[model samples]
Each structure stands twice: as structure tokens, then as C-alpha cells.
Target: MEQQIDSLFNWLDETTSIIEQEENTPYIEALIAASNLLFEQQVPEDLEPNYRTQLTNQVNAIQFSDFEREARQKAMQLAILKGMKGATQQHHYITPETIGVFIGYLITKFVGGQNSYRLFDPASGSGNLLLTILNQQQNMEVDSYGSEVDPTLIRLAFNNTNLQEREIEYFHQDSLKPILLEPVDVIASDLPVGYYPDDDTASSYELKAEEGHSFAHHLFIEQSIKYTKEAGYLFFVVPSFLFESEQKDQLQSYLKEHVHIVGVLELPKSMFQNEKFSRSILILQKKGPQTRDPRKVMLAQLPSFKDVEATNNVITQIDQWFKNDR
Candidate 1:
């Protein structure tokens, strides 16, 4: 499986390099290569004939149908990670696989018994995290939806899911703006942390800052809560200091009124280069008759992912808390 993933990624890399020779950006090159893999035919029309032939030959050599779902997903993830590294845009970073897998495990614990449910990711960049969760929950039917404002990322997302043969309805617009979507049962996202530039749109959010641009992550929390069903679950990858900024009071007040805190699991500090850039997974449930604040909020610092035994121990503790305490 590892060898297949590496080979598939190598093909993608070679094709992307060929396309890059035509002066396309890294993101576009990846998109083109992935699209060709999905459709089994080259899609770009303006490349030099030799380059087009080379891309087509590379596509012909691989039998994408032979790769397993997880293998294909991992290969595409590597391809996207490469593009992200070359991208100048700060928001292009792909959610790490470890984080995606951990979020999937948590979601499965809560929703695994359901026959079917809807899930949404408002800040779904290239569809990696959303698809990762979906891939992990193959036993249950999931109606997935995603929204993104960046054209390139959205295009890449469409291709990514299409290649995996996963169905998802996507909204290509600013997630903060009003979206025509039905409320979902589960919401998961690696919330983009920063100030939202559109003050006018921020104006409509209850969590909007009293002055100046509002924190985008805060607004995303408000938006996710708004589109969630009664008692639905929300898992967010947020900065460690989410509630320590200048806008903490307002955010805390808003959360207090709208949702029950389920838990906050601080990610391993070793995963990040600096403590200031560290993050945590925040678990919350929308306020409803079926929901109540956990008797004891689940809080713990995760050990480095490299420490397999310690990580599993923490996971076992989390499992027990859900089974016996919460």
C-alpha cells in the first residue's frame, strides 16, 4: 500500500512538473494532473504538444482503479501538500493527516451508531479533512457539504472528491455570508484563524467584534452553530489561545448562550515549531433538550504523536470518559 501511494504520487509529481514547465502555478499544475487522473484523459488544451503527450502517457501508465480508497486519498494528499508548500497563500496549508484522523476518530465515537447523518465543513480547503472523516466512516451513509471562497482551492477540492468517488455539495463563496444550506447534524473544520476583512458581513454575526474587523474563527463558530441541528456536534481545530484574545469575553458569552462545552484536547506541542502556533481540538454540542454540559469537561494535553504508547493511553482515557462519564 505504501509503495502504491508513493508511485501514484510520483506520477502526479511528474505530470505536475510537466505542466509547470508550461508556466502554470503549482496549484493549477496539481489540479490539471489530478483532473487528468480522474477523467483518464488530459484536460489542458494549451500545453505544448510534446508536454501534452508526456502527460497523457503518464496517465495511461497508471491504473487508478487498482488503488484502494485510502491509498488514493493518501497519494492525493501528498500531491496537494507539495502544491501547498510551493503556494504563497497562507491559507493553502493542508490539514495534517494526524489531525484529520484524530478528528475522524472523535466524530465516529459520537455519530457511529447513526444510520445516516449530514456533515459540513465551512472552511473546507481542498476537501482533505472532510474527506478524511468521510473515508473513516464508510460504514455509515454521510451527506457531506463544504464551502470555500478561493477558486483554486475549490477546484482542487472538486477534483479531489470526484477522484475518490465521494459525493459532496460545495458552496464556492465566503462562508461568513449567508449560505443556502440546510442545518447539518455534524460540523468539523480547522477554523481559519485571523481577522475577517469584511466588516459588513461580520456586522451580522453576534460574535462580531465591538470595533474593527472581527476574528474569522469566532465568526465561523457562530456560523457553524447557526447551521447545526439541535444537539448536533461540532469539532473545531482552533488556536490554543482562542479564548484569550481581546474578543474573548464576547466569544465566551456567545458560546455560553448557544452551546454546551463537551471538551478541549490540546494537541501535542511537538507537532508545531512554536508554542504560540500550537492548536487544540474543541468539542461542543448545540444547546438542546437532548444535550447537557458534560459533568466534567474532557481536558488533557496529548503527547507527541511519535510516542505511540502514550498517545494510545490518552485515546483510551478519552474512550472511557465517553463510555462511563459523559
Candidate 2:
């Protein structure tokens, strides 16, 4: 609508005013450009609206999506054929509202009725996942913890939480040997996609001061079991290759032996088409004291252009499962 555009224009002008007040003209310009790309076009009602939003870097600098949400939406829609590339790839993934919708639905449905939940994220990339929890649960208090190795990324995560007025306890530590021992009910992470480790450079680890362990990915998963409570659940994004790779047979076997695979969300290759490797989200349940549902194996195929409202739609699905008459 013409009126809608004018309102958006006005809002952006106000935002630019703030940027100008701060003397960040260049940054403001970039934001203005990116905002246009996100809102310039209309998305299908059935599909989530995608946009290129500001993601503050660790250095407290702004990072813009090279391509606007328009590109992201197309890439997502044609994700199977066209992988992520260019601007969309360089940008830190996620939007403010989508993150909240997904996790808010999860918390309200699965973890809500309890007195409280001990929440954790081993690989809290940019604190996107953590921010969702804080935004959704404004009233109740939960014990929160996170483990991120990159100091810069960790610093950004911490600062973002504070900027949002979120209450959480985060630490700069190896995802594998996370220091926190607080009992956790739900553990989630957008881990170092197998293709991209925390640093993305094996040599960087050698170049850095700290000595390291091999197979950081597996080590982290193995340790996730250790850090989690008996009935606790873990939701993670791992490469699809993990499912059939014989190299991970033991890890998979170990999981089946000691834990439970509640479901495997076979993701679209589009999830990380821009990257070298394919990706998927795996939901695991710690084999402990919590009630188990043998009849169900929950799975979700995350669509590209994941808008918050569309993200909330998934919650409606989850609610049916959790609210079912047992």
C-alpha cells in the first residue's frame, strides 16, 4: 500500500535521524538501503517474509546483508536449486522476531508448566537462540547459560543480550567442555555447521595461544550428553552427512545406547545452500527420567525466509503434539 510505504519511509527517516545524531551517516545509509530491499517487495502469504536486518558485529560495528531479504527469499524458495551465495552468505543468519516465535512456542508448549527450566546453548552463535528465549519469557525466570569459544562472537552475544535487557549467564568456553553444571531442561544450538568450525580455520587454532582437541564437533556432542540432565532435551543443527557417515557410527551408536533420538528434522539443502556442506536440524532426548513418547518422532523441515510469524506457525504444530491427550 502507498500508505504503508510512507509509514515505512517515515520510520526509516526517524532511524536515520538517530544515526545522523550519532554521526554514523555511512552506516545509516547502508541500513536505509538494506531496509528497502527487505520491504520493497511483497512475499507470498503462505511463505515467511524475509529481510536483511542489521546484525551488530563483535567489535560493536554494523554488518549489512550484501543482498537484501528479497535475495534471501528467492534463494530460499529456489533453495533446492540455487544455494546461498554472496550477500546472504556473509550476513549473520536470523531475524529478531522469527527467533522469538520459534523458541517462544517451544517454551510455552513443552517447558512452560514446570516451576522453571534450566536452559543452555553450547554453541550460541551470536546469541540468536538465547535472545529468543529472553524475548519470549519476560515474566518467568529461568537459569540460563551458554558456551561460545570466540571471544569476539561471545562479546557480541553478551552485549546483544544486555542491549535487549535480557537476563542470561554466558561464558566464553569451548562448546565441548562447557563449564556450566546447572541442570538443564532444554539445550539448543546452531552449532558450527560441520563445514565451518567456530574459527573456520584449523590453522587459526594452531596460530592461537590455546592447545586444542581433535574432532571438536564430536567432542561437543559427546559433552552435550554429559552436561545435560537425564530427562533433558537437545536440539542442534548438524550436517546431514552425519546420519549415514560411518565415521560417526560410534557417535551415533553411543547416542542410541545412552540417549534417544526423538526425531531428525531433514532440512532442505537450501538451509545452507550457500555453504560448502549441506545442513539439517537434529532433536535428541537425553535418556533419563523424563517421560518419553514412543509413538512419535518429531521432524521439521525449516523453510528459507523464515519470518517470525511463519516461525510461530511451527509452534502451533508443536502445541498439538505436546497438548495431545496422553
lDDT agreement of model 1 with the native: 0.87
Model 2's alpha-carbon lDDT is 0.53
Please write out the lDDT profile of model 2 over residues 259-284, one tens digit for every residue. Answer: 77776655545555465466666777
The candidate scoring highest on lDDT is: 1
lDDT of each: 0.87, 0.53
Off by over 4 Å in 2: 1-100, 195-214, 268-271, 274-278, 289-293, 300-320, 323-326
Best by TM-score: 1
Off by over 4 Å in 1: 27-30, 42-48
TM-score of each: 0.95, 0.60
Relative to the true structure, candidate 1 reaches a TM of 0.95
Model 2, residue 75: C-alpha shift (Å): 22
